[model samples]
Every structure is written in structure tokens, then in C-alpha cells.
Target: MKINSFLLILLFILMSSVTSSSQAKEKAKHVIFIGLDGWGAYSVPKADMPVVKQMMADGCYTLKKRTALPSSSAINWASMFMGAGPELHGYTQWGSRTPELPSRVVNEHGIFPTIFQLLRDARPEAEIGCLYEWDGIKYLVDTLALNHHALSPDYTEKPEVLCRMAESYIKEKKPTLLAVCFDNPDHVGHGAGHDTPAYYAKLKELDTYIGRIVSAVEEAGMLKQTIFIITSDHGGINKGHGGITMQEMETPFIIFGKNIKSGGEFSESMMQYDVASTIASIFGLKQPQVWIGRPMKQVFK
Candidate 1:
């Protein structure tokens, strides 16, 4: 009787462990961060971005104002991914003159470890990938030793190409984190103001690309397990960023997908760094100590 009771107890313990492990796996969350290089909050309503508009309506959005120092792409993107200010990241502008080199040089090295690096270390089992037009993010990914795939510098891609790449990564690697940066609207807006017909057309093109990604996720059957976050680095000035104007500083923040409460907007003041922190929280990882921004917990519902 004693031997039989001991065997039954062992079996019960093994079953309990298996059940707990399966439950933990079921609760795992995946994140896809979509970056619109130069989108601004003020332009979102007017811009004909149907998919993004629908996401805003169906999920949580924040008119949460943004301010970027040196508002340049290199600086803002570094700040956003590193979750630290320029002072910490040491990426003040697009170009940093190194006294060691006689000629002017661009500073490609960011000072702090990026959120990607932290995630890679904390969650090695999680697959990760990044598609970005800027070299700054690539530098961060390389420095952090994170797993990622970058887009070409020319920012040229057929809809099919982008879709195929994303689909293959999700299907083959099953990455828990995916980051994509689209630069069309930003480039067009810089050449032409947001009100221009060209800018509106670019917005529509961006929406179509976004729709493709959404469809791909749905088809992959990962839609319910994924969290989609769409945001921008900084807005543009009259035709460019790196300025103090509201048009150049304020941007949009939208979140959709599993576990997210629908239909709400946050008008409170927020910064770009919030993106990294929020993503960290979604993965059940502790925010990096160097991260300065607070996680916008209200958006998670």
C-alpha cells in the first residue's frame, strides 16, 4: 500500500508540472512593432491611412505628445530603441565628428544596450527580427547581439517582397518579436507638406502595406497571439524634423491585438522611449534600468 501511494503521488506531481508548463506557454505574448518613420499625430486624421485609422478606432491610441532632441532620424530612433536619452546613448545627431578622424564622421555606435539586446538575453528562446531602413537600428541590433534582419538602405520593396519576408520569418522562425520600419510617407512628406496630394497618396500606400501585414498575420494564425504596435519616431517640421515645432515633435501611438482593450485615446504627454518600455512589459520582462520612459500601462487594459 505504501509503495502504491508513493507512485500515485509521483504521478500527480508530474501531471501538475506539465499542466503548469502548458499554461505558461499559452500565456506567452508576441509583439510586432511597426514604425512609421515620420508620422505625426496632427496628420493622422487627415492622412488617408485607412488601416491605421481603423486600428486607432479598434484599439488604444495616444495623442501623447512627443519631443525629440536634434529631432533627426538617427538621434530619435536611437533614443526610442535604447530607451535612453541622447546624453546616455551618445547619438546626438546624424553625424558625430570624431576628433581622431580628420574628416567628418557619422556616429553609428549607440552608448547603451538596446531593448532588443535585453530581450535577447532575457528571452533567448524567443525569436526576434527587425526590418528597418535606418542604420541606427541596425547598429543597435548588431551591438546588442540581437537576432534581426534589416531592410535595404534604399527603402525600395515590392508589396510581395515585404510580405514574403515577413511571412517566412513568422512561419519558419516563429519570432516572438518583429519590428518593421516604413519610410515612404516620411520621405514624401519631407519633399512635400502633409497637405499635399503626394503626401496623401503616400499615406494610402502605407495603409495598403499595413493591410498586407495584418492579412499575413491573420493567415499565419498568429493574430490572436500577437500584439501589434504602430508608432513613429518623430514628426516633420515644414518639410523636415530636428526642430522644436509641434508638427515635428508630436506623433501617434496605437496598439491593437490580443489582451489589449479597445477604443480609447491618451492625450497625456509621453515620449518615444515609452515604446521600448511598453514592449518589454508585454513580454513579461523587466524594463531595463537605463530605460527612462514609463510603460503606458493604461493601453494594455
Candidate 2:
């Protein structure tokens, strides 16, 4: 009987350890999610994005992260934010301002529940904002949930201006969550063709923008308390996405700062919806029952 008791105690201790390791030691005070529209994992090898490369080295990353079917902007963006694919969230088209199909569920805000909505509902005082070059992002993120939301004048002509605005917002508000979405890469991809010189040049430019945002966070004395996530809506082919090609479906997902594993590469399969779930986990917020995303908890140390 004593032997059985001892064995049971050992099993309990093992289970406790597993549970502890699965959870973050401390919840993040700030999470910066940077979305690069149409940046493909295939271009990572050839692009001169030193800032992004450094992020990959410093954090847990996966080049194999996948977008939802019909790899396009609005559909995958909804998946990333809503924590479910088109069938569930119902934002099925390339640039859908509203759901092409009926959403399975919605929150008090009267739209699909997004990470922003989740945070707002749970922590009413938490500062949440988003700055994007794409106007369509407003519809996806549920602007009513955000404390602040802005659309850049023109991404292709003045990308730096958007970055500066993001920097200023970070330094001033010290937001609990901030999403900076760049539409330049996708515009360039469609205009000059994906995997071309212009596409790479555009990516390089956006990398500088990311660097500026990181600096702004550090300048605000929130560096140690902040987590950074970089990902994309979809990739592209010759001139467009919305297809099943590897280039269109595969995008890089990088998570760095504050309790993340250093130089770790996530080998597990991850979906676009998982990004929202991961953010929810970092904030220690309970995910809505409608969300199908599973957090990439292995990224935490």
C-alpha cells in the first residue's frame, strides 16, 4: 500500500511539472503583433531583411506556418485575428469588408470575436490599438474594440510615415496590444510580381520599419515586458495570391522577447489562427468557445 502511495505521489509531481512548464511564468504586459502582407517564407532566403533575420535568431520561429485556404488577404487576416478559419469566422473572400458567409458566433460587439475584442471585454482599461496601411483591416479587427485605429496615407509612397506613427503611439500610449500592418509588400508583389527585385526591395524597406517599432518599445522602457510577433496574411505567385501554391500558403511566424526561447525553431505544425490564440495565452485571457485556434505554447521557456 505504501509503494502504491509513493508511486501516486511521483505521478502527481510529474503532472504538476508538465502543467507549470506549459504555462508562461508571467503574463506579458505588452504584445506587438506586426503583420506583413504577402510576405512569403520562400522569400526569406533571398530577401535582405536583416531585422527579421535577427528576430528569427533571437526568438522561436517557423517558416512552415500556414495560411487558411484560398490564401488571400482578408480571409487569412480574419483567421489570424478571429482564431478560426473562413468556415467558422465567415470572412471568406480576398478583401471581404464583411463576412461572405454567416459567422458561427459573435460577441457583444455584434461581429466575430477577435483577439482585440477578447482583450477589451476581459480588461476594459487595457490600451489596445492598430495602425495599418490597409483599410480593410478596420473591418477585420473590429475598430470599436480598439482604443485607436489608423490607416496610413499610402504604403507604397510613404511607408516610413506609418512606422513613425506606430513608434509615436508606442512611446505615448505604452499599449497593452498593438498591431502594425504593412500593405506595401502585397502592393509591390501584385504590381511587380512576387519573388522579383521590387518585391525584395519592398520587404527590405519594411524590415527597417519593424526595427523602428522595436526601438520605440525599448525607448519606452517596456522592452523587458513586451513580446513581439511577426507574421503575414499570405504569400503570392507571379502577381497574385488566393491559390494553394506553397508560396501563397507558407508564411513565417516569429515570436520574440519576454520568456520566449532564444534561438529556438518551432518544428510543430502551426496555423494562421494559432497567432490569435498565442496572443490570448500571453495575456492570460480565456479564449472564446467559438475559437478553434491552439496556442503555440512550446515557444515559451
Best by lDDT: 2
- Residue 206, candidate 1: how far off, in angstroms? 0.6
C-alpha lDDT of all candidate models, in order: 0.71, 0.92
Candidate 2: residue 13 Cα off by (Å): 17
Candidate 1 lDDT tens digits, 16-120? 999886555332367888887888777877878888888888888886558568666766776677676676666676533211222122223333666677677
Cα RMSD (Å) between model 1 and the true structure? 5.2
- Residue 172 in model 2: shift from native, Å? 0.6
Runs in model 1 lying further than 4 Å from the true structure:
1-28, 95-111, 153-160
Ten contiguous residues minimizing lDDT sum, candidate 2 = 19-28
For candidate 1, what is the lDDT? 0.71
Q: TM-score, each model? A: 0.82, 0.91
lDDT of 2 by residue, 66-87 (tens): 9999899999999999999999
